[model samples]
Target: MGIGDVSKRVLLGRKLRSSQLGETLLPKRIALPVFASDALSSVAYAPDEIFIMLAVAGASAYAWSWKIGLLVALVMLTVVASYRQTVHAYPSGGGDYEVATVNLGRNAGITVGSALLVDYVLTVAVSISSASQYAAGAIPALVGHEATAAVVAVALLAAVNLRGVRESGTFFAVPTYLFMLAILGMCGYGVMRLLAGDLPEAESADLVIEPAAGWEGPLGQVALFFLLARAFSSGCAALTGVEAISNGVPAFRKPKSTNAATTLLLLGLIAISMMMSVIVLAKQMSIRYVDPHELDRLRTAGGDALPEGYEQHPVISQIAAGVFDHFPPGFYFVVTVTGVILVLAANTAFNGFPVLGSILAQDGLAPRSLGSRGDRLAYSNGIVFLAVLSMLLIWIFDAETTKLIQLYIVGVFVSFNLSQLGMIRHWTRHLRTERDPAARRKMVRSRAINTFGLTLTAVVLAVVLLTKFIAGAWITIIAMLVFFLVMRAIGKHYEEVELELAADEQDKVMPTRVHAIVLTSKLHKPTLRALAFAKATRPNVLEAVYVDIDSRATNQMLREWDERRLDVPLKVLHSPYREVVRPIVDYALEIRRANPRGVVAVFIPEYVVGRWWEQLLHNQTALRLKGRLLFAPGVMVTSVPYQLESSQAARDRRRRDDHRVKAGDLRRGRVVRDDDQNQVGR
Candidate 1:
């Protein structure tokens, strides 16, 4: 094969037949990491965000960290329970978009789709950006180049995901599991130490935090309420990926809905555990975390500023250090896995976005190209599109996790609130006709759960807008609106095109006559071949036409035509401006104008070359001529290819490549033995 093909094969492995799609279905073991990584990995930074928001009021506000964590966890649990009903109701993988569209209306569905699409892109950006920060801490060389490093990490993750869902999941499953183990193990050990009354304090435990300007004294109830609301809004980022499982139920194996529900439950419980543990441990260990940019707020006990260049570690990292103080290896393992899992967390978005994109495409709301699977049975276009948009975001935000975090969770919650509302409507609509009392009772229960979810999420969404709209969430809202408008325009265009392309009775009418013209520059083999092919069609009129840019060459060609004594007539059009394509185009258009009810067929000979550079050397005039003729009414343009000698090499290379044995070819009985080939030749 060619170099490009070989490289792709090496990168993505062998292509699989469409029938092998069932083989790619993931079991519960693999599906857990594939879809839950984003929610699980949020524990790494969710607590940090909680502390950053609380730090505005200084360390005194840190006492509320555990309370906010529980609040976020409670929202997550309700969301998970709500989506369990969603998967059972809509197992087709449309997730929120499908639910909203089918229950609410077209506009509602499009809103959910747009919201999810924006959120998925932000997921990749936020996850990879966070990972880059961790990498910068571990490797000092990456401190100033986190954006560049993040872009590269996004590209690598996209490449791995392009190799098909099952394969990418298998690759990422290990790190995701390791992260879970490391965090849980660390939390368990830290709690044990606390029970034994021997838990060491965090490295920054002694540092005193000074309240920001205007907060020098005790705060009123109003100020305290606002502060806690903002902190809770920020902490709610833990709920961002809870809906991914509903969006990806089709990727699961047998009993897809059940497996997906189980996975969602597992994700919610584990995420809540890890998140609550980190917060409680941070509080117990007196982890003095603050906004990385505002580290100056932290003061030494003697009322001295922290030394310049004193880096503040993340909440989890500080807790890991204090819990594993006696064993450096434990600290390193926890830190390493945390960083790796953050990067892999974007895989959840990579899987969800493309499937949702495909669904939109199938519904004519997105470009049709996004619906087609690549050679590896993955939605390659959607993956690449997500990667590019995320890289742009990373570059624009300079890969600062704190800055990007402000734009996070807005879209997901938009989808979450709409999805829960739609689910409530879904059960209500179905209960009207579901006759069986047992089934009715179950539907009523599901409706109640969804109703409760809707209430909680609706409140969260309002709080998010109130607290974060000025903090960067406005950008996400604007993005969702743009996506909605664009998809609506696409759907309208597809509908119009469908109507315009529908066949009618007039389409069956034949042309009155066929007027054929073979474009010729010289009396050579290619020109002669075109003329012969045109005559064989038995048109009502046939002739050879030439554009005479030079009189000397025109006369020489005329002399050759006369010498050959050809039967077909040759007509020459003189061009004073030395333009070749315009004259041919004008002549064809004139003919078309003269015969509105007839057809004008223009055959042009084009050279086919194998080498890429050879293409630039030929076919410039013919290409332009054909392009111009295509727009003329009642005119048909055809290219009669004359293959150059170099083209044989391309054909031979393709033949050889087609015969080569690929992985699984022998097992599938696609390989031809040497003896069998010899017998066929004999």
Candidate 2:
């Protein structure tokens, strides 16, 4: 293997056959982490957001943290149930975009698609940024360079996912499960300690919180309502990845919808449980957290400020520290696993965004390149695209989770509202045609569920807009609008191209005359081959066209043409500006202008090289000439490739590669038995 191939194999592992796609499908246990990691990992930071927002009003408002969690959990449950209907109704993995397009109109679908696209990008950015924050907390050396750490984390995740879905999932499964175990086990043991009246207070319990200036004397009902609304909206970050399962139904094993739904239920239950437990424990232990910049608000019991650079640990970190203080290993275990899982949470977007991009490409709404899978049978282009976008966001926001969080749940809620509305329409339309009484009843129940989901999500959407619009949420909105316009423009462009290319009687008509011109620089093997091929066509007009870039070579070529007694005529196009492509292009156009009714076929002699540097060394002039000639009317550009020795080596290498066994060969029914193999060997 070449160095490049070996490096690729090392980075992405072995390529899987298309038949191995079934092996990539996940059972519920694996799918839970694969699709639900984002939602599950939010338990690490979602409560932090809630506490931070409430901290603005001092510890007095902290009493409402669990209430906000309940509300957010309620919305999550509604979304999960609504999407269960979606999975069963459209198990082809179209998810929200498909539901909106089919039941609502194309514009609605595009809006949902754009929202989901932006949401996926933010998922990676937010999750990785949060992970970096946790890493910095655990390792103080990484404190100031969070953005750089997050960028590196994103690169690592993208590389793992490029290997294929199942491999990536397997790689991440252990950490995700460990995070669940650590957090839940901590919560369970903390509760037991509390019941025994031996629960320890959080490290920050002695620090008194001072409410922000405007919130110090909160007395009006309007003020309290707005404060709670803001806290609730921030808490809803937990719901960011709930819809990933809907978009990834096809990646599940047989009975895909059922498995996806079960995974979705598990995600909601675990995320809700963890979030509530952390909030309650923080309150029970008097954990104090505020915006990182507002550390002045925290005071010692003596009414003195804490020392400079007093970094407040995250809510979960503090809770873990307090709950496992006696068992130092448990605290380290929870902290380590939480940070790892938060980073891997971005894996959900890596898997989801690519599949959605592929579907969009298939629908002509995205770049066609996204539809092509890489050697590992994964959407490698989409994976790289997501990584680049996430890196840009992390750089722009400096990988600060609080800043990135403002741009968070807005896109998700936009998709949620639209998708729930779409699901309602989907069930309504189906109810009209579904004849069985039981199925009708089921459709009615599902429609009702979607309706409730829509209502709840619409309210949350309003709150997200109202609370977060100025806090960077408008960036998410603008991104969605840009994506929607770009997709619409792409669809329109494809439609115009298809219409223009439709076949008709004119397509079948032969040209009045065939005029062939072989583009050549010298009378060497490549040029001679081009001339011979052009003559084989037996055109009414055949000539060799050369631009006089160098007088010495031109003179030598003319002398060889005459001395060799070549049957084809040789024409020299002079260039005063010392340009190659324009002279030859002008000559081709001049010929077409003279014989407007005839076709001008320009055959350019080109060298095919296996090495990358060889490609750069040759074919500069020929490539430019062909590109210019193709746009001219009544002109056809053709390349007669002359393969170099390197090309033969490349061909042999490919032959050897084609014979190697891949992951899904047996499932594809292409496996050979031992008897046939032995006969061939003999």
Candidate 3:
């Protein structure tokens, strides 16, 4: 095999056949980490966002941390329940986009699709950027290189996912579960210490928070409400990945919808527990964390600003330090696992975005390329697209979580609100026809749940728009609108092409006569073979056509053809500017112009080179000629390949690859028998 093939196999493991797709189906254990990592990993930073927002008003606003956490958890649970209903109702894996399109009409579906697409991009950017920050906190070397670290992390995640869903999930499952255990263990230990009245204070417990250029006294009710709304919107970042499960129900194993719903419920319960527990612990331990760039807002207990070069850790890091103070290993374990999960959280987007992209492609709203399966049966194009766009965003924002977070949840909530509204309409239409008592009762329950979810998510959407638009949410809205318009244009293009290509009565009619033209440069084996193949077709008119770029070469070719007593007439088209492709294209069009009801067939000799660079030296004129003739009306262009000696190397490489071990081959009991070798030999 070639060096490139070996490198790819080493990176991605092995090629998986189409039949092995069933083996890639995820079970609950793996699927939980694969699809739920985003929502679960948010606990690492969701509490930090809450604390950072409230820190604007100093510790006085800290009292509302638990309140915001609880409210966010409520919204999360509502979303989970609503998506459970969605998965059960629509298990085709289209998720919210499908629901909206089928129930609310095309525009609503397009809106939801565009919103989710933008949110998926933001998910990767925000998750990897946050992970880089956590890495910087734990390792001093990564402080100023967060953007570089984030881009590298995104590339690695894309490679892992390119291997396929089940494989990548298995690789990430350990870190996700470890993160859950570490936080839950820390929270449990911290609570035990609190009960024993021996819990140590956080590192920043003594530091005082100063309001950011605001009043030092009590605020009016309107100001208080605005502050709460801002904090709540920031805390709702935890809900960013809740809808991924609905989009990925087809990835589950047996009982796809049921497994998906169960996974969603478990995700909600675990995420809510971890989020609220961390907030409670941070408050109890008096963990102090502000926006990293706004460190001037913090003062020492002596009421003076801290000295320069003093770094502030994340809320979880500080809480971990305090909770596991006596055990340094436990502290490092928590920190390490937190960083790993933050990176793995982007896997949720990797899984969902590709699936959604495939569905959009199938619906003609996206490029048809996104619908193709790779060697691993994954939507690799979509994965790579998301990775590149995410790296661009990370670089643009310099991997600052605070900067990217403002653009984080607005798209998600826009999708959330519209999805729930669509679900409400879906059930209402179903209730009009569904008659069984038990089924009707279940549908009614689901409708009521979605209705409630719509109300809650709508309020959150408004809050997010109001509080974050100026903070950068407008970028996300603009991105969504651009995606919507682009997809609409793509759909229109596909429709027009389909209608133009549709066969009718005129398509089946036979042409009046066939005129075959052989393109020749010299009387070599390739040219002779092309002439013989063209004559074999027995066309009404046959001729050897040459572009006379040089008069001496054209005269020599004419002398050889006349001396050989070739039966076919030889025609030379003169190009004053020495253009090869356009002259031949014009000649063929002139032939078709003479007989309007006839077709002209043009056959050109092409070299089949094994190596890429060799191809650059040959077939330059023939390639351009074929491209031009393809656009000519009533002309059929064909390439008669002349395989060079070097092509044997490519054939040998293909033979080797066919015998290589493939993914799931052993599990499927596929042994490479003698017949496989004989087939390659043949």
Candidate maximizing lDDT: 1
Higher-scoring candidate on TM-score, 1 or 3: 1
Residues 1-682, candidate 1, lDDT per residue (tens digit)? Answer: 7788889989988888999888889999999999999999999888988998898898999989999998998899999999999999999999999999998899999999999999999999999999998898888999899999999999999999999999999999999999999999999999999999999999999999988888778989999988999999999999888888998998999899999999999999999999999999999999887788888899999989988789888888899999999999999999999999999999999999999999999999999999999888889999999999999999999998888899999999989888988999898988999999999999999999999999999999999999999989999999999999999999999999999999999999999999999999888989999988998999999989988888899999999999999999998989999998888888887887888899999999989998888999999988888778878888899899999889998998888767766667666777656744531110
Q: What global local distance difference test value does model 3 have?
A: 0.91
How much is the lDDT of residue 612 in candidate 3?
81
Per-residue lDDT over 1-682 for candidate 2, one digit per residue giving the tens place of the 0 to 100 score: 6679889998998778888889888988889999889999889888988999999889888899989989999999999999988899899888999998988889998999999999999999999998888788778899899999999999999999999998998988888999999999999999999999999999999999998988888548998899999999999999989999999999999999899888888888898899999999999999989999899999999999999879888888888899988889998999889888889999999988999999999999999999999999999999999999999999999999888888998988988988988888878888889999999999999999999999999999999999999999999999999999999999999999999999999898888898899987888899999888888888889999888878998999899999999988999998878998888778888888998889989998999998888989999887777777778999988899999999899889877767766656666665665844531111
Model 3 residue runs over 4 Å out of place are 649-682
By summed lDDT, the worst window of 10 consecutive residues in model 1 runs over 673-682
Error in Å for residue 483 of model 3: 0.6
Query: How does residue 648 of candidate 2 score in lDDT?
Result: 92
Q: On lDDT, who's better, 2 or 3?
A: 3
lDDT by residue (571-641, candidate 3, tens digit) is 99999999888888888999999999999999899999999889999999888887778789899988999
Task: Name the lDDT value of residue 457 in candidate 3.
Answer: 95
- True-vs-predicted CA distance for residue 37, candidate 2, Å: 0.5
TM-score of each: 0.97, 0.95, 0.95
lDDT of each: 0.92, 0.90, 0.91
